[model samples]
Target: MLLALPPLYLKYFEDGYLLVPGFWTIFFFISALTLIVFVVVLTVQQKNNEMYAQAFLGATTFKLLACLIFVLIFIKKGRPEKLFFVADFMYLYFLNTVFEIYGLLRTLRNQNSK
Candidate 1:
């Protein structure tokens, strides 16, 4: 699926900068998908939500950092390219998707345990 994007993305890059590499789109997609595995793994991997949440928070913080860098780059350019401005949000979106999935899984576990 990822391999399918570059030519199409390049076709549209004329419309605007892609911000992150084409590879990251695949990575974000894959990473977001892992939350199901994450939830399943949680049953055996970590003993509690706090540990998982902490790790997830740290990872999400990194995603935000990557977005912030692109934002800073866009800011430094002064003109602020519209494509990057929008692309920058993908990081937040990816992080939010993962965080929400994790949160929902945790909630489900807590509810089920009770």
Candidate 2:
């Protein structure tokens, strides 16, 4: 998610890499959102704990920045092709979300079993 920001937003929107393979971008978006949500729920569960709370807020801020940057780029692009890429990006976001959810669940189960 955060690791892939430059290519997804900067390259795709700013440098016109919109025509490149979008599988990575899609995976990134989904992964980013999933982690964002996971961090959020974890934060809520550990509401009174400062360490986890800080991490969650940090992640929320990053995700918010990414969303803002995305919207800003879209406003500047303003084209049908751009819209197409955005859809592809969003599709990947959800796919990554599911994968992250499964991964986190597996991690929890493993820790419990151990």
Candidate 3:
């Protein structure tokens, strides 16, 4: 939710310059995917620490593929403008990727300490 504020503010207050159509849908999809990946990684960490790296790699690959498919479909169906596409891509993928890394690192740190 915190990641949503900047885009939301830009969309509403800045005349919707940086947002594409269906921004909420894109946001929710990424959010759900991130949450699912995080949960799967943590479950793997708890169940088999030695397999954590493989699980994380698998999850990351799945996320990238899913995002690629989603972007292709969105481009075909939504026909969003180039600027909107760039903004949406950065917000949806880049920010989420950063968040996922931060979350994974924090979780791993906590697990190691315990």
- CA RMSD for every model? 6.6, 7.9, 1.1
Best by lDDT: 3
The better-scoring model by TM-score among 2 and 3 is 3
Q: Write the per-residue lDDT of candidate 1 for residues 29-103, one digit (tens) a residue.
A: 435544544555465335664566565556546655665675566456555555664555554455556565666
Model 3 scores a TM of 0.94
Question: Which 10-residue window of candidate 3 scores lowest in summed lDDT?
Answer: 84-93
**lDDT tens digits by residue: candidate 3, 9-108:** 8877898866888888888888888988999999999999999999999999999898889889988998998887877787778888889999999989
Alpha carbon lDDT of each predicted model: 0.54, 0.56, 0.87
Residue 106's lDDT in candidate 1: 73
> How many angstroms is residue 2 displaced in model 1 relative to the true structure, after the best TM-score fit?
5.3
- Which candidate, 1 or 3, has the higher lDDT? 3
Candidates in order, TM-scores: namely 0.39, 0.43, 0.94
Which portions of model 3 show Cα errors greater than 4 Å?
none
TM-score of 1: 0.39
**Tens digit per residue, CA lDDT, model 2, 1-114:** 443665557565796545344446435554666666676756554465435446555655666577658656654665435655666565555455556556556645674596
Worst 10 residues of 2 by lDDT: 17-26
* Span of ten consecutive residues with least summed lDDT in model 1: 16-25
